[model samples]
Structure formats: C-alpha cells, structure tokens
Target: MTTAHDYAHQNQERFQQQLIDLCRIPSVSTDPERKGETLQAAEWVAADMRKIGLNNVQIMPTPLHPVVYGEWLGAGPNAKTVLVYGHYDVQPAVTSDGWDQDPFEPTVKDGVLYCRGSSDDKGQMFAQLKAFEALLANGKPTVNVKFLIEGEEEIGSPNLGKFVAAHRELLMADVCVISDGSVIALDRPSIGYSTRGLMYLEMEVFGAKQDLHSGAFGGIVHNPAQALAEIIAQLHNPDGSVAVPGFYDHVVALSAAEREELAKSAWTDAEWKEATGVPAFWGEKEYLLHERIGARPTLEINGFVSGFYGAGSKTVLPGKALAKISCRLVANQNADQIFGLVRDHILRLAPPTVRVEVRQLASAGPALMDLNSPYMAAASRAYEKGWGQKPVYERGGGTLPILADFQRELNQIPIMLMGFGLQTDGAHGPNEHFVLEMFKRGIDTAICFFDEVGQIK
Candidate 1:
C-alpha cells in the first residue's frame, strides 16, 4: 500500500489547486447578492467529494443556502462512521474593507494563501477532502466517512438544526470532526475541547421623533446617544465585571487542573498586547489573558451607531441610537436566559426620558467535548504523527452553535476538533491568509486520523 506521506508528496499541487478553486467562489452567505455564489460554492464542495470517489453526494437545500452532504459507507457495516462538519460560506469582504487584494482572488505570498475564506472554513474544509483523496489513493481508509458542509454557518446556521433533526439516521455517526478554528499558535497542533456560547443582541434607544439642533435641545431633552452611552457604561462595574444580575449564576468555575493546563500554553500578556496593538489589556480582574478569553464569560459592544459627523461636527441630537452587543457565555450558561437578564437590566437602567428596546439577533448554546473520548485520543495521535509534536488540548472563546445542535440531534456523539490554522492567519479580518505549511500538515493529520480511528477497535 502507498503510504500517506507518499500520497501527500505526490498530490501537494492538486490539494493547493482545490483550495484556490474553492476560494474563487465568493460564497458570502449573509449578502443577498452572493446567494448564487453561496450555492455555487456548495456545488463545488459536492463536486470535490465526488471527485474523491465519495458516494451519495447531494446538495441538500435549506431555507437559506444549501448544505452539501456526501458519504462513503463502503468500509462495511461494522466500520465506525465519522461525520465531518464544515462550512463553505465565508464572511463578507470587499476592497473597501482594506483588503491587500481582491478578497475572492486567491494569492500566494510568502508561503501563505491570502483570500476571504482561506483560513476560516473553506481552507480547513478542503483539507479534509484532500485527506480522503490521499487515503483512497493509498488504499488505507479504514472507516466510513461522511461530509456535511453547509453554506449558512456565517449567518448563525439558522436552519441547520431543523435539517439535522430531519436527517438524524443519515448523519448518525460514532464521532463528528470539525476543522473550522485556529490551531494553538503556530507549530502547535491543538484540539478544541470546548467553545463558549453566544448571545448577540441589538439595543435601540429612542428620544425625539426627529433629529434636533444640539444648541436648542441639548439641555431641554434627553439625548438618546447619551442615554445609550450611559446604559452601556452601566453594564459593567468599576472592577470590570459584568453587572447584569444573574448573568454569572450558571457559569461553572474552572478547575484548578484546567487552569494549570491553560497556564502552561505559553500565552504571554505582553505578546497579546503587542498582537492587538492595545496600550493595555483588562478583563475580569484576576484571571490570565488565556482564561479571560477561553474560560470566562465576557460582554462586548460589537458596534454602536448614534449621531452623524461625516466630515465636520454636526451639532445635532440624534433621535435614535443603536448598539450591537454580544456576550460570550461559559459552560452551563444558557443563551436565552442570559439575553433576558441583559435586556431586563438595560430596560431598568434606562431613564424615563428615553425608550429602549432590545432585539435578539442570534444565539447558540455552549459546547464542551469529552476530552477522554476515544476520538480525541485518536486525533491526538494523528496530530503527533503529522506535525511531529503532541497536540495541545484547548478551548475557544467564540461559539460554533451548530456544534451543540449536532450533539443534541445525534444522540450526544462526541465531536473531535482537529484543525490547522493560526491566530495570526487573520480569519475574519483583512489580509486573511492560510499557511501552506499548516495546510499540508492538516491534510496529513486528517489522513492519519483515519488510520488511528480504524485502529481504535
């Protein structure tokens, strides 16, 4: 049998070309204009699965964008089925967003592939496909594999729950693997053991019926913008902890062992500050930066829009002010419950002069994977083989909502997160790129995972 290393050496160019082809689709699910592109990307993913000899490839339509599902159950009835989950959709990008080049046009610079979806999901998702190709070409695949790539993940995956619920039998698997996040720093293969939940909301404060001259109405009326600022300020206390009542009631405290493990990961506060270019860093007071980001819950004002001052200062009191807020929830916390508490707190804190209304934008439950599961052990060994280093177990500050949904719908099957990307890759921002070295390593890691999974029994 041809070894995985030999297959990788021979197919390196083909793997890179596939990622370039996937990046050129412009699959931005949030924009209406790119709806066609979203479906086209799904088609592209399906076609790649077919090219890899995966049977039963189908584009399952959703209310929004479609999901690409394919499976190769030819490993026989006793073989364990592994469901691979990833998204083909990408966050919207444009030249006005400060891209060094066209976001959809893939470019190779300094051994990095720069594009909109280069590192987020498209690049990671393509890695799994190439892994399958290598396994098939080498005649070494030992377990059943299924692919479930969706195009609406960037939009909160609003319809995925229903779809998964509808097709439980088809998606039933011993384990689910995801490769959608950054690895633990460069040269460290990481496994995401948990992800914080998300509750995104928009708060709007209303003052007058229309804009009024600041000189005339500044003292006479309560400015909605001012009220909005005050309300946001009151969300946290002087100590920098969120002030919402019952907000942390359900947050499970981290264990001492977990804290020690996190501390050993070589994350320095000075390094974080330098990376963010921030003068200083502050969080919930006592925790380290890694803990603050990964284990602790946080509330952030994602965006705020109030008054207008385009070129010059316009002395006008805006009639309305809006703010987009999101909370990263820790383990055991519920999204709806936390959102309710925050909304009530804002309403109670609002002055009688202005009316405030809160709208829930999106929400997803927190997910904690069992680190002791067989699949995680298999993934660890796979990464060790591929990267020549033992994998580090870690958690993410951001949420992948469908992860929780997959567990709930699939009878609590353990999900394994084994990805190849780095924080410096710039996933959601400008100059987003994926390291070619990591990309090749990811393919090798995935191919190794299949062999390791087969050995588990």
Candidate 2:
C-alpha cells in the first residue's frame, strides 16, 4: 500500500516548483500599490485549495485584504478537526533594500529557495496544503482539516479579529496549528509555547511656540530636544531595568523545570554576538539571555526625532520633539496597566520646562499555550518522526496577535506553533529564503500530526 509519506516523496519536485510559483507573486500586503498583486495571491491559494479537493474553498473578504479558507471534513464528527493557520502576505521588499536580486523573483541556490515571501509565509502555508494533498491521495485521513490563510498578517492583521469573531463556528476546531515562525536550527526543531505582548506609544515634547535661534535661546529657554532626551534617559535605571514603579508587579516567575527546558535552546554568547554583531550582551544580570527575551518584560525606545537632522547643521531649536516607544509584556501582566505606568512615569519625569504628551498607539496581551495538552504531544511526536529529532520547547520573544485572538474566540483551543523554517532564513529581510528540505519535512510532519491527533479517543 502506498503511504502518504511515499506520495510526498514522489511529488517532491512538483511541490518545490509550486512553492516557487507562489513565491513569485509580489503579495506585499503593507504596500497599497500592491493591492492587485495581493488579491492575485489570494486567488492563487483559493484555486489550489479547490484543486487539492478541499471543500467550500472561498476568498473571504475583509476590510483591507481577503482570507483564503478551505476545509476537508470527510472524517466523521467523532474525529478530531485541526485548524491550520498561516499568512500568505509578506513584508515589502526591493533590490534597494540590499537584495542581491529582484525581491519578487524566486531563485534557488544550494538547496534553498530565495524570494520575498518564501520563508515568511508562502512556503510555510503551502506546506500545509501539500500535506493534506498527500494524505488524501493515499486514503482518508483520520482527522478533518481546515485552512485559514490570511493576507494582512505582515501589517498586524488589522481586520482578522473581527473576521474570526464573525466566523467562530466556521473556524472552530479541536486545535489550531500555525507554521509562520522559525525554529532554533535546521536540524534542531523548537516549539514556541509563549509569546510576549506589546504596548506601542508615541510621545511628544513641546517647548517654544516656534523655532528659535540657538544663539538667542540656547541658555535662557530649555530645549525641547534636551528635555525629551533627559526624560528618556530616566526611563531605565543604571542597572538597565525599567525605572517605572510597579512595572514587575504582575510578572510570572519561571519554574525550575521550565528554565531547564529553555536551557536546551539557549544560544551561546559568541553565537549571539555573531548574529547581532553586538559588542556585548546587556539585560537583567539575574536572568539568562533567553529568559530576559521571552520570560521578562521590556521597555524599548524604538526611535526619536527632533531638531535639525538634515544635511550639515542648523542653528535652530525646534519647537517640538517626538519619540516612538514600546514595551514587551510577559504573561500575567496587563497591557493597559503597563501603558498607564509608563505614561505616568514619563509625565513625572518631564521637566516643568517643556510640555510632554504621551499617546497610546497600539497594545496586545501576551499568550501562553497549554504545553501539557495532547495536541502539543502529537506535535512533539510528529516532529520526532518527520525531522528525525526530538523538538525543544521555547518561549518566543516576538508577538503574534492572532494567537491571543484565537484563544479568546475559539474556546481556548490548543494553539500549536509548528514553525518549520530556520532562524537564519532571513524572513522580512533581503534575500529571504526557505530550505527546500524543511518544506518537505514540514509536509511529513503535518501529516504525522494529523494522524497522531486522530488517536485521541
């Protein structure tokens, strides 16, 4: 009897070519000019879903972009249903962004496929579809499957919350699996069980009513830029921790067992320096690098602009200064509470010389998955079978809004982040690529997960 793995191996060449084709489309969702190309990509996915025998395939419309949805529920209701989620949209790219070749033109070299959307999503999402195809070609899968491939994840998924809320029944399942991130290494797989939340804020400081000559107002009038810099300088203490009071009030402490699991995937200082090109690592001295990144909360000054930064030099004191700030919250901490604390601290730090204004731009709560769930166990077994290695568990430093949104709407389904790409895949950057072998293994892994989940009677 021909097995699904056999079918996957037989169609490897065709699968690679199809991924290349999908990567060719310039579906840069954040770019308004690429709206047509984005729609084209959605249609391509919907058409492929139909060809793969998925029923009720449709291009569901959102306010900005559309979502490509499909399902195969041939397995009876008694069987488990797996909801697969991924984004087809990619970050905007061009040769001017330091690309060696055209960003949209998919190229292959040394067993890696390079293109804008290759690793970010097009390749990962396509792997799920191919897995289903292989399973159906051999025989009926023990579990049902559904796909929710969106087009605006790169832009923070502005409309996805509403879309999911309106289609709760249609998208409900036993568990939701997402393959949109990166693993620790090509050979060493890692499952991300938690992600940090976000609180983005914009701050402005105003001093003089209008621009003034430095020679006249330099000593008498306080410079708004100077005030802004002083205020920002106090946001962090000399120890590099946030100075805001009650900042760590609700942070969850990591258990000794969880710390042991994280140690398995810890990057050496040399490796971190090589990747980040930093002179030295700086964070809370009490916590390890990985813990500071995934377990602890953080306040970062993204960027600040003021005065004259153009050409040579200008002798004018600008009327206002602006700074972009953000905080990464951990589990148990409220986004709103963090924002309020930061805002209040900044106000208190601002000198009476200049008027300060802080605005909340965006916010999202943190998400932690139930690692003990049987669905996660199935994923672990699937990785062992497909990747030839037992996977490690890690907490992601980044934030994915969809995870929290899914938890709230889907009755707390076990959301599995089964990322397939490697950390060095260069996602969202120039020369982004996906290893062809990872794509193949990802298909086999997905197949194994579906079959393994079916046994949960």
Candidate 3:
C-alpha cells in the first residue's frame, strides 16, 4: 500500500504549481485598492479546501479582511485535533521595491520560487493543506485537522482576536501548529517557543501651521522637522538603551540556563555582518546579539517624513514632521502600558516651540508556548523523521498576534511553530523567495507531525 509520504512525493509537481497559482494573486491586505484581490485569495483558499476533502469550508467575513477556514474530522472525537494557523495576505510589493521580477508573478529560478507571500506565508500554509490531501488520499489520518488561514496578519491581525473569541468552540483543539516563520538555516531546523510582541506608533510634531520659507524665518521659528529630530535623538541614550522610564519595569530577565541555550543559536559577528553589511553592531553591550533580539525589548524608528524636496531644494521649513516608531516587547511586558510610557516620555521631551502628538496604531502582547508539551515533542520527532535533524528550540524575534489569543481563549493549548523557510529567503523585502526543497520537506514534516500527535492519548 502506498503511504502518505509516497503520495506527497508523487504530487510534488502539482503542489508546486498550486503554490505558484496562489502566490499570483496580490492579496495585499494593507492596501485598500487591492481589496478585490485579497478576497480572491480567500476564495481561492476556500475552493482548494473543498477540493481537498475538507468539510465546512467557508470564507468567514470580518470587519477588515475575511478568514478562510476548513476542517477534516474523519478520526473520531477520541483522537487528537490539530489546529493549523497561517496567513494568506502578504506585504505590499512591487518591482520598484528592488525586485527583478513582478512581485505577483511567481518565478522559478535555480529551485527557488520568487514571489510575494511565498514564504510569509502562503507557501507554508499550503503545505498543511497538501499534507492533509496526501494523508486522505492514502488513508484515514489518525488525528483530525483544521485550518484557520487569515487575510489580515500583515496588518497586526486587528480583527482576529474578536473572530477567535466569538468562535471559541469552533476553534478549540488539542493543539495549535503555526508554520509562519523560518528555521535557523536549511540544515539547522528549529522550533520556536516564544515570540516577541509589537507596539506600533505614529508621532507628529506641529509648528508654524503652514510652510515657511527658510530665508524668511531662518532662526526665528523652530522647524517642526528639527524639533522632531531633536526629540528622537533623546529617546535613546549613549549606551543604546531606551531612555523611556518604566520601560524595563515589567520586563522579565532571562534565567542563566535559558541564556545558555539561546547562546547556541546566537549569530556570530561575522555572520551578522555578512547578512546585514553593518559597519558594527550597536545595542546593550552586555547581552549577546541573539539575546538582544529574542529576549530584550527594542525601540526602532521604522520611517520618518517631513517637508519635501521635489527635484531641487524647496527651501521650506514644513509645518509638521511625522515619524513611525515600533517597539518589540519581551515576556511579562504589557503593550498598552509600554505605549503609555513611551508616549509620555516623548511628550516630556518636546519643546514649547512645537506641539507634539503621539498615537498608537497597533499592539500585540508577547506569547510563550509550553515547551514540555507532548505536541512540541511531536514536532521534534516530525522534524527528525522528515528533515533528518533534531530541531533546536529558539525564541522568535517576530510577533504573531494570534498566539496570545489562542492561549487566552483556547485554554492555553500548546502552540508549536514548525517553521519551514530559511531567514535568507528575504520575506517582506526585495527578491522574496521560498526554496522548493523547503516546501516539499514542509509537507513531509506536517504529515509526520500529525502521525506523531496521533500517538498521544
């Protein structure tokens, strides 16, 4: 009798083509103009779910984008149920963003599929779908499976919390598996147990009500742009730590044993320099680079804008300046409290010459999974059997808003992050791509994970 792995191997070509088709739709959730395309993507997922023998497939609408949900429950209720989560929406991309090809047009070159959403995370999500297809084609899977692919992950999943809250019984499961991130490398597989939270904010400094000529009001009026820059300069101290008081009050310090384990995955300075091309590293000098990224909190200026210079110099000191800031919070930190502290600090730093306003755009609390759960052990065995390596435990530097909700609403079910792609895949940037090998292995790993979970109970 042919096995699920054999079925997956036989359907590799078709799976690759299916992924290409899905990635072709530019489902950019953040762009209002691409609403139709985003809906198309959701419809596509629902259609495929029906094709793959999943039951109750639907395009559930939300305040923003819709969520595509499906499930297979051939196994009796006595068996374990695995909840799979991923996002179909992608970051906005264009050829001018430094891509050699159209971001929506999936391109295959040297075994890498280049396209937006391939790795983050349509490719990974589809792997779960295909794995179930293979399993059902071969025989009945011992464990039941459900899919919860959403369209708003790119925008912080603002409506997902409400959706999950309203559908607790529908989404309740034995465990949750998320395949939205990257492994340490192609050869070094890893499982993520903790993810950092995010707090995004926008700050605007106002002055002079209208544009003023630099020659007319040279030193008399304080330029909002200059004042904004001055305030930003004071946010960080000389030692590269945030100057915001109370920022560290709620942060949890890493234990000595945990620090030792994190060090195993720390990027060497040479590797960091090779990947980033930075002249040198900057941050708290005491912590290692990995600790600074995965364990410590961070404040970053995502973007800044002010008076414009079209072609030549406009010679104007614009009325206002705007800056986009984001903070990555660690465990035990609250996003709302941190936002208040940062906002108050910025306001205090503002000079009387300009009016400064700070507003929060988004926030997600940090989440830590139970590493000792049997589901995590199943993930480890799956990686070993499917990818021929024992996976290492790592703390992810990125944020996934749904994990916190799953923990809160779903009775704190164990969440396993079975990342398939590599970090160098350039997700959310120019030349984004997913390796064909990773896609195939991801399918195999998902199948193994289900089988391993089946052994439980």
Candidate 4:
C-alpha cells in the first residue's frame, strides 16, 4: 500500500493551487442575487470531478441549486463501494462583517488559507477530490468510489432529502463517508460518531398595531420587547437548566461506558475558556461542558430583534419583538414533538398582555452510527495510518438532518464521519480559515481511508 506521507509530499503545491481556484467563486446559497455564482461553483466542482478521473460525472438539477454526482466503479462488483458526500455552497460573507479581505478571494498567510468557505466545506471537499486524483494517477484505486457533492447545504439543504429519495438506486453504497466536520485539535485527530438533531423556530410577540411613545403610554400598554424578554427568561431557571416540562422525558441517557469515553475526551475548564475567549464558562451545574454540548439537549436563542437604538436613545415601545430560537435535541427526541412542547411552554408562560406566535423554521432528526460495524473499524485503521495516532471517538453538537433521511431511503449503510478541519477554523464566523497542514493531511487520510475500506469483508 502507498503511504500517505509520500503521496501528500508529492502533490502539495498542485492541491493548494486547485483549492485557491475553487475558493475564488462566491457560491453563497442563501442569496438570490448569487444564483449564477452558485451555478458556476457547481459546474466548477463537476468539471474538477471529471478531471480527477471520476466517470459518469453529471450535474443533477434540483428545485434550488444543482447536485453534482460522479462514480468510478472499476474496482469490480465484489469490492466495497464507498460514497463520499460534501457540499460546495458556503455562508454569506461581506467586508462589513469583520472580514480581513474580500471573502470570495482566497488568501494564504502563515500556512492558513482565509476565505468564507475554506473550512466550512469547500476546502475540505476539494481535498477529497484531490486525494482521489492522486491515488488514480499513481496507478489504480482498489475500491469503487462515488461522489455526491451538493450546492445548498448552507441553506439547510432543503432539497437534499428529496433528491436522495428520488435517486436511491444511483446512490446505493456499502457505507457513506462524510468529510465535513472539524478535527478536535490541530495536533490530535478525532472521529465524530454522532450528531444532535435540530429544531429551529421563530417567535413574534405583538403588543399594539404601531409604536407608541413611552411617555404617552407609560404603564398603560404592554411593551412587546419586555414581553419577549420575559418569555425567553422563562425557558430556563436559576440552575441554567431548561424549564420546559417533560423535555427530558423522551431523551435517552448516555450509557456508563459512553460517559466514561466522553470524560476521557473532555476538555479542561481552562481550555474551554481559552477556546471561547470568555472570562468563564457556565451551563447546567450538574453536567460538564462536554455533556451539556454533546450528550444533553439544549435550548438556545440565536437571534432577537425588537426596538431600535441608533445614535441617540428613542423611547418608543415597538409594536412587535422577534426572536430566532433553536434546540439541539439528543437521541429519541423527535423534532416535531419537541417543537410542540416548546410552543406550548411559551404560550403558557407568556403574559396575557401580549400575544405570542411561534413559527417553525426548519427541523432535522439526530444521526448516530453503529460503532461496531466493519466500516467503522476500517476507518479507525485508516486514521491511524494517516495521522500516526489512534483516532478518538467523539460526537458533535451540530446536526445534519439528511443523514437520517439517507438511512431511511437507502439501505442501512453505516455512515462514517471523517474530515480535516479544526474547531478553531471559524466556519461560520469572520475570517474563516483552513490550515494548510490539515488540508494536505486530510487528502492523505482520505486516500488511506479508501484503501482501508476496500479491505473490509
């Protein structure tokens, strides 16, 4: 077998240049004005897949952006087929958003590539394609490989589930490998075993038809902003625990062995503080940070908007207040069921002086891979060979809804989570970057992973 060290060293410069080219296109999926740019990015990815020797490359159309599909099944019918999944779309970025430079133009300095999609997915996905090219160019691949890169992940992948359901036969595989997560630490390699599900909601509280001067309506009318604040405060109690009744009734508790494993990978308080740049960390007093984020369910208010304050203070009671709320649910917690509980809680706690309305924005079920599967064992060996260290098992606080959908539509193929970005890469934040070293290592690791999966019985 070819070693990752030698393959990476041989093609570092070429891979770096290709990534820069891919990052140059502004493929933000949320903006309607960037529709053409989104298509351009999709085409670029499809062209690259063909260049990498992937056969039957095609740009499958969806209601939104296109889905890029390709496959190289030359390893014979007996060989295990591995499906690789990733996204080419990225979050919107602008200069006013604290960006150091133009977001679309990739910049490399001090071994870090800075851009909007560098770490979120484009860079990571590109690395896998490059790895395939390197392995094919060297001689021949031992495993059948398929690529299913999409262009609408940043927008909650609203159409991916439908696409997967419609083309089940085309996407059949022994197992699916996702290269979209981040490394635990820059120096240590980790594997994600599960992801929490998500329930996103928007709440609006209405007081009156229009804004009124505080002096004119002081103490006479209800303030929507105050009412919104009260509703939010009621979601939690003094112990920093969610007060939603029966919220924990359906949640599955982690096993004793799972708890021990989480404890082993648990970050120290100091490290947590440093990573978040906060003076201190706080959460449910009984659970540790890792447990609160990974194993436990959470309710978070992501965004809130109400009255206006520009330059000078305006004493006007806004007519309505809006809030964007999301919950990260653990295993056995259904998104729709949790959403109903949240809505009911808000209605019961809301003051009669104002009317509150809850709107469901999006939702996805949680995903967990069977760790005992042979595919996981192959991946463990692959990471060990690539990183020179045993890969640590971990779970992410985020959600990938389509993963669960894939399981329902296709056969129950064990999903593998593997990627080469770091947590500090600033995926959704300003000046997002992907480490050059990690990018190259990720390519090597992917190549090694293919070889290992091929050996699976």
Worst 10 residues of 1 by lDDT: 1-10
* Model 1 score (lDDT): 0.88
Provide the lowest-lDDT 10-residue window in model 4: 1-10
lDDT of 3 by residue, 350-446 (tens): 9999999999998988987766678888999999998778888899888887888888889988899899998888898999999999999999999
Displacement of the residue 401 alpha carbon in candidate 4, Å: 3.2
Q: Which is the winner by lDDT between candidate 1 and candidate 4?
A: 1
For every model shown, what is its TM-score relative to the native structure?
Answer: 0.85, 0.92, 0.83, 0.84
Query: Which candidate, 2 or 3, has the higher lDDT?
Result: 3
Query: Candidate 2, residues 1-457: lDDT per residue as tens digits?
Result: 2399899999999999999888999999998999999999999999999998999999999999999999999998999999999988999999999999999899999999999989889898898889999998988889999899999999999999999999999999999999988887878998989999999999999999999999988898889989999999998888879999999999989988889989998988888889899888898998998899999999999998989988998899889999999999998888889999999999999889999999999999888877788988999999999777899999999888888889889998888999999878899888999999999889998888888898887
Highest TM-score, which number?
2
With a 3 Å backbone cut-off (N, CA, C), the pairs that clash in candidate 3 are none
Winner by lDDT between candidate 2 and candidate 1 = 2
Question: lDDT winner among the candidates?
Answer: 3
Q: State each model's CA lDDT, in order.
A: 0.88, 0.91, 0.92, 0.87
| Per-residue lDDT of 271 in model 3 | 93
**Model 3 TM-score relative to the real fold:** 0.83
lDDT of 4 by residue, 1-457 (tens): 5744466678798889888888888999999999999999999999988887899999999999999999999999999999999999999999789999998889999999999999889988988888788778877688899899999999988899999999999999999988898777766788888889999999999998999998999698889999999889999878887899988888877777777877767889888988899986777878889988887888999998998968899999899999999999887788999999999999998899999999998888887776678888888787788766678788788888878888778786778889789878989899999999888878878888888888887
Candidate 4: segments with Cα more than 4 A from true spot = 3-8, 31-34, 92-116, 138-140, 204-234, 237-239, 274-282, 302-324, 349-356, 426-432
